[model samples]
Target chain A: MRLKDRVAIVVGAGQSPGEGMGNGRATALTFAREGAKVLCVDHNLKSAQETVEMIGANQGTAMAFKADVTKEAEIKAMVADAHSRWGRIDILHNNVGVSLSGGDAELLEITEEAFDRCVAINLKSCILAAKHVIPIMRAQKSGAIINISSMAVITTYPYVAYKATKAAMVSFTEQLAYQNAAYGIRANVILPGLMNTPMAVDTRARTFKKTRAEVEAERDAKVPLGKKMGTGWDVANAALFLASDEASFITGVTLPVDGGASVRRG
Target chain B: MTRLAGKTALITGASSGIGRAIATRFLAEGATLLLMDITEAVVEGGEPTHKILDVPFFQGDVSNEKDVDEAVRRAALPTGRLDIVVNDAVIRIGKKLTDTSLEEWNRVMAVNLAGVFLMCRAAVRQMLTQEIRHEARGRIVNISSQHGMISSPEDVSYGTSKAGVVYLTRQIAADYGRDSIICNAVAPGKILTGKTGRAVEPRWLDYSHARTPLPRLGRSEDVANAALFLASDEATFITGENLMVDGGWMAG
Candidate 1:
C-alpha cells in the first residue's frame, strides 16, 4: 500500500508480443498492487486494455488509454484524461524503449527513419509528457517522476539510437530534478540490464533466428549474479521504490538494476 | 507485509547519525537487530539507540578486527543467520592535506578504510555459510561519502578512505555476486544528521547549500531510507551500486 490512492500515469504500459512480461506492464501492475490508480497508456490499445484488465482482476484501480506517445496532441490528451479523472497526478512513469523491434542497428546500417522513431519513443516522449505534467505537478507542489533508462548507457551496446537516447534521458532527468526541487517534485532514472522481459529476450530470439533457450542462456551468461537474467519484477520493484515515499530524499540519481555488470565499467 | 520481516541485521556506528537512523528504520520493518559502536554514547545527546530499541549493543571499535568478528558472530546468534550488515563506522579528520599530521591521517584510514575492509571480510565469511533467502545469502551496505567522488572541501584523508570504500563495495559485489551476497554503498551529501558544531557552522552550511540542488538540506532519515532500500528484498537485483541520496548534490 505504498502508493495508496495515488494517481499514476504509466506510459507504454503494454507488453510486447511474446512470452514474458515487459517492463512497462510489470511496473504498472506493481504500482496498482501497491494501491496506485494507474492510467495504462500504450500505442496498442488492446495491449494497454489487457494491462488494465489484469489490474482489475487483482481488485486494483486502473484504466487503459490509447496514445502513440510520440505525438504531442495525444500525449496532452492522455495527461488531461488522467488529471480530469483523478484531480492530481502523483506519479509519472515513462517506460517506453526499443532496440531491435524499432529497427535499431549499428551506426552505419541504421536508417534516419528508424533512428528518429527510437528518439521519439525513447527520448522525446519522456520530455513531452513531462512538459505537460510538470505544470500540474507544480500546482500541487509534489510528484515523483521515474524514467526507465538502460544499463547500455554506461555499458557497451551494439545499437546507437538506444544508447544515445537513453543517455540523454538520464541527463534530462537530472535537470528535471534540480529545477523542480522547490516544488517538492523528485525525478530519478533506473537503468535495467538484460532483463528477462518479452521485449528483451523474445525479440532477440526472433531477430537472431535462435531458440528462446539459446537467447536466454547467452544473456544469462552476461549477468554476474546467480548467472541468471533479472526478471521484470526487479525493475518493477525499483520503480515502486522510487515512486513511493520511501525514496523521499532521493532525486536525480541513476540506479542500475544490473546486478554487478555496470560495476565492471572499464 | 513488512519489508524486512524476520531478517537479522547488524549495523556498525549505530549510536548516532546515519547508522542510528538506519537501525530504527530496519527495526520498524521487522528486522531483528544487533548494534555495534565504539561506545553507547549518542553523539547528538539523545538516548542510546540500542537501549531505546531494546536491541543488543556490542561496544567496540570497528578498527579492531577482533571486535568486528565477534560482533558478526553474535549478530548471527539471534537467528543463526546474518542477513544484512551495514559498514558505517567512520572517523573524520577534516583538515587540508598540508595541515594534516601523519597520526591524524593514519587514524582516519584505520577507522574508515581498514574498518570497512575488516567488517566486510568478517560478514562475508559468516554469510558464505548461510543459505540463500530472497535471492541473497546476505547484503552489505557500506556508508560512503559524496566527498569521495568529488572533493570534500578541506578533508583529504577522509575523502580518500571513502573512495576506497566505494571501490571495496564494487569489488565485493563483483567477486561475491555468484555467492548471492549483495553489496552496495549509499553516498550521502551534506546530511544534517541532527549533529551540532562544525558541520552546521555557517561557512560549511553555505558551501553545502550551494552545492546541493534540493530545496532543503538532507536529514539522517534521508540516508536511512536509501540504506533501507538497498538492504531489503526490493533491491535484490541491485549490486555494486553507490546510490546517492544527495538531493541532487552530485548531480548538480
Candidate 2:
C-alpha cells in the first residue's frame, strides 16, 4: 500500500529456475505486492515474461520488456515503452549485475576486454539507465533510483572487477543524488551480503569449484550471527523502503542488507 | 509471543530516549529486561516484577566498571544466562571545537564510548561463561549515530564517540564471531527525541525537513523496528553490521 499506484521499472528482472529469486524479479514482485505497476525488464524475454505472468496471476499490474541493459538503445527503448504505457517512472530499481571470475591479477594479467565487459555490464548500464531516466524524472519533479550493489564492495573479495564496479555504483549514487536533488529525485544503493539465491548458488558453484551445498555451508559458517545467509527478499524489502516515501529525505546512501556478514571477519 | 520470549536482555541508558524505547519494545516482545541508567530518577518508575512486569531497573553510571559488573550480575540472576545487550547509554555535550572544554569532552567520551566498551566487556565475559543454547550465542546492539559516519559540526566529541562505537562494533563482531556472539550497531539520523526536538533551532527545521527524503524526522519506533530485526532470529546471519534507521537522512 505504501507504493500504491506508483509506476516502477525493475531492470534485470529475469525469473530464475528453482526456489530462489534474483534481485530484479524479487523487487518486481515486491513492488507489485505493495501496489505498484511494474515493468519487469530482462535480457531474456522468457524470463521477463515469467515475472509478468506471476504478477498478473496475483492480480497485479505488470508487463514484460526484453532489453539488454548494457545496450543504450535497448535501455532507451525500455524507458520509452514504460513511459508510453504508464506515463511516469516513479521508481527505477537498477538490479542488473554479473560476477566475473578474476582474482587478484597483476595489471598485466587483467585483460582490457574483461575490464571493459565488467564496466559495461555492471557499471555503465546504471549510468545509461540514469541518463535516460533522469530527464523523465526531472520533468516529473520526483523519482527514486535504487541501485543494487554488493557487500564485496566494502568487504574485500577476490572478484576485483565485481568489487570495483560495485564500489563505483556507490559513488555513482552519491554523485547522482547531488546532481538531481533539486528535482526531488533521490538515488541510493543497496549492498546485499552473501545471499542464498539462485544467482548466489550458481556463482559460488561455478567460481569456487565447490558444490552449492558446500559453498552455502562455508558462506553460512563465516557469518557471525545466526550462521546463515540472507535471502533476495531481504534485499528487496530494503529497496522497497528506500523507494517508498518513508525514505523521502534519504539520498546518496549505501545500505547493506547483509545479515551483518560484511562486518563479520573470518 | 515476544520475539525474545524467555530471553534475558541488559540495556544500558535505559532511562530515556532510544534506550528506553528499546527496553519498552523488548519487554513488549516478552524478553526479561535489565535496565541500567546513570540517572536513578529517570528509571525509577519502570522496575521489573514477577507478573505483568518484565523490567529490572539498575541505577548506575555505565562508565564505571563496578556499576556494569553489578548490572550484569543482576541481569544473569534468574536465568543464569544473558542473551542480548543493547548499549544505548550516551551523553552528548554540544559545543564547537573552540568552545568545547576538555572536561566536557572527556566526560562525554567516558560515558558514550567508554560505557559501551565496559558493558560489552561484561556481557562478553558472561556469554563466555554461559552454556550455548542450540548453538544460539549472544547479541549486542550498539546505538551509534549517522553522525558517526558523517560529520557533526556542533558536537565533535559526540560524533567522535559514535564513530568509535562503529569501530567497536566491528571489532567485537570480528573477535567474538567464533564464540557465537554477534555485535552490531544502529545509527539513527535526525530522530525527533526530547533532546533533539528541543535543541534543533526552529529555523533549521524547514531545511532539515526539505532535505530529508522521507520528508519527516525519525521516531524512536523506527529505530526500535530495526533493533527488533537485529535481535530476533531473523538476523541470525548478521553480525558487525551497522543498520541505519534514520528515515533516509544519511541517504540525502
Residues A1-266 of candidate 1: C-alpha lDDT, one tens digit per residue = 89999999999899888898888999999999999999999999999999999999999999999999899999999999999999999999999989889989999999999999999999999999999999999999999999999999999999999999999999999999999987999999999998899999999999999999999999988888878889888999999989998778789999999989898764
True contacts kept of each: 0.77, 0.35
TM-score of 2: 0.78
User: Each model: TM-score of chain B?
Assistant: 0.99, 0.92
Best candidate according to lDDT:
1
Q: What does candidate 1's lDDT look like per residue over B1-252, in tens digits?
A: 488998999999999999999999999999999999998999998789999999999999999989999999999997999999998888887899999999999999999999999999999999999999989999999999897999888999999999999999999999999998999999998899888888899999998888777778899988888898899998989999999988788777
Specify the highest-TM-score model's number.
Answer: 1
The C-alpha local distance difference test score for the whole of candidate 2 amounts to 0.80
What is candidate 2's lDDT per residue for A192-266, written digit by digit as tens? 888888777766687668787887898887665556777777777778877887556567777776656667544
Instruction: Give the fraction of true interface contacts kept by model 2.
Output: 0.35
